[model samples]
Target: MKMDLGDQGLAGNAAAGGRPLAIEARGLIKRFDHFTAVDGVDLAVPEGAIYGILGPNGAGKTTTLRMLLGIIDPDAGLRRILGAERPHDVAHAIGYLPEERGLYPAMKAYEAIAFVGALRGLPLAEGRKRGKALLEEHGLGYAIDRQIRQLSKGMAQQVQILGTLVHEPRLVIFDEPFSGLDALNQGKLEKMIRGLAEKGTTVIFSTHVIAHAERLCDEVAIIAGGRVPFAGPVDLARDRIRPQVRLETRAEDGAWRTALPADARREGRFWNFTLPESGIEPLLRALIEGEAGILSLSIERAGLHDAFVAIAGEAAARALEEGETEERA
Candidate 1:
């Protein structure tokens, strides 16, 4: 069956520059009894961009996503999806993959994929056709007729992802999409996300893994303890932390020692410290003039991990590190 194309107007509006924001939430708050889960979070996702919501476990990322999807209403906030104040009418234009995975064990892979598409306003026959094409394109052609229980965990995930995109939604939302996949599968998913953006689909996903956000997101919001401390381009977040300089020299006792920044720490013949606002040229000149034999010197630029540690605090950074360690184990 042919799918209704009513929601195509939303995508056209974006192409025509009617509204640049595909998703927006302002002052969103959620409370469970006396305890608040989400606190005054604001978000803006540009059309055709891959946006990431990054936070440690229990940082209210899922709650914020649910509210934005209209699966649950926020106690205080305004949210718009595809320019609609309420998402109900535009629900069919969006595709979502929840953190939790579910499927009938006995269902065939194709049927499962098609069923999800049907729910997204795709007709069963059309869903099946598209599902088959997606599976084959993703290298799962042999598994189409196989039962869900017969497939491996990674294969099952690909089927689910195909289901999410079968209806060709304009905006795709994935909550913790890479939680359980192995490294290879995770890499594949990353490529798939980029491909979606290339095709003009707005993508938003929540993750605790900073590496994914660092590699995939055009912009990210960092949330911790139910509040967002930073949100914007990845480069802006990295700017929150200072760059470090590492130096090793044969001559230790000289004007170079005095020229070192107050925060500098010496470890044997090496010195590690952040660059001063005055810059490194003066320090380099002092080292040379002081007869300090500079064996090697290198500057280390700040990364997303460093930015997270600075903006979210040591406690939240520690939590994220612990989570990654657990995932690896």
Candidate 2:
């Protein structure tokens, strides 16, 4: 979807939900031995916004998420989660779903959820009650008593997701949450994320998939080579590239062709080019006056995928494609 190109603000002001930041990180760095995984990363996520950390596999997305969650201390830099400088201090208020999905095969669906909640300080009984309600609400009530191994892959994944929310956390961080789901399940997950944001829960998710971020995120950070190249509102990223113009005319050659920019490319009867800085009015006037016989004319704002390619460079974009291919395989 194309958003109107507006102010070039990062996640602040209205973009930050007019509330305090739920997460703030500055110059976060993580290293493994001599290998640097995340370098000089920074992020500002609002209290009730859905923010996405976008990058390909091996781009330090997971490492960055781990740093934010306090699962692993950053070798350098600082971070604050849910207004606490120490993420552990706010552990009970946060929910995390790691990229690696796991659930004891022998545990029943509701039991598994309660176990996870217990780890986060939610009482087992309360968790079970919430778990059953969540399952029924999400159309999984029939699977409530079934063991994890007995459920389908999609069902198991859903169970784990429910477990993540069983404690009703104020902040949720999901690393590559859509990694292995089918189309239907992916849609469900997207809806769930939106629901959380609607209820004033802050959500931060890392993913290589651009479509999800484009559709759901209010602000995003485009990371490449273990660093962020751009971080701001989705519309700002899209505005990095000018809107494209698609024009179909009956005339093969005329003064209208002269008015078209030199960068315009002709494909049969269609002429395509970047919308001129002077806008489409001048171009339309020229076409009409020159009798170009316009059959169709439309302006298309760049999508998030195109904006990502423009901001992250072709190499990083290619890496993202390769990651998607591997996921499919």
TM-score of 2: 0.92
Q: Write the per-residue lDDT of candidate 2 for residues 91-142, one digit (tens) a residue.
A: 9999999999999999999999999999999999999999999999999999
Please give each candidate's TM-score.
0.88, 0.92
Give candidate 2's error at residue 239 in angstroms: 1.2
Candidate 2 off by > 4 Å: 1-19
lDDT of 2 at 192: 98
* Weakest ten-residue segment in model 2 by summed lDDT: 1-10
lDDT of each: 0.88, 0.90
Residue pairs with colliding backbones in model 2 are none
Model 2 lDDT at residue 239 = 95
* lDDT (10s digit) by residue, model 1, range 1-329: 12122433223223223548898777788899999999988787889989999988889999999999889888877777898878888989999999888878898999999999998899999998988889889888999899999998878877888899999999999999998889998999999999999999999999999999999999999999889988888989997877899999988687668999999998877899998888889999999999899999998889999999999999999998887888778
Task: Give the best candidate by lDDT.
Answer: 2
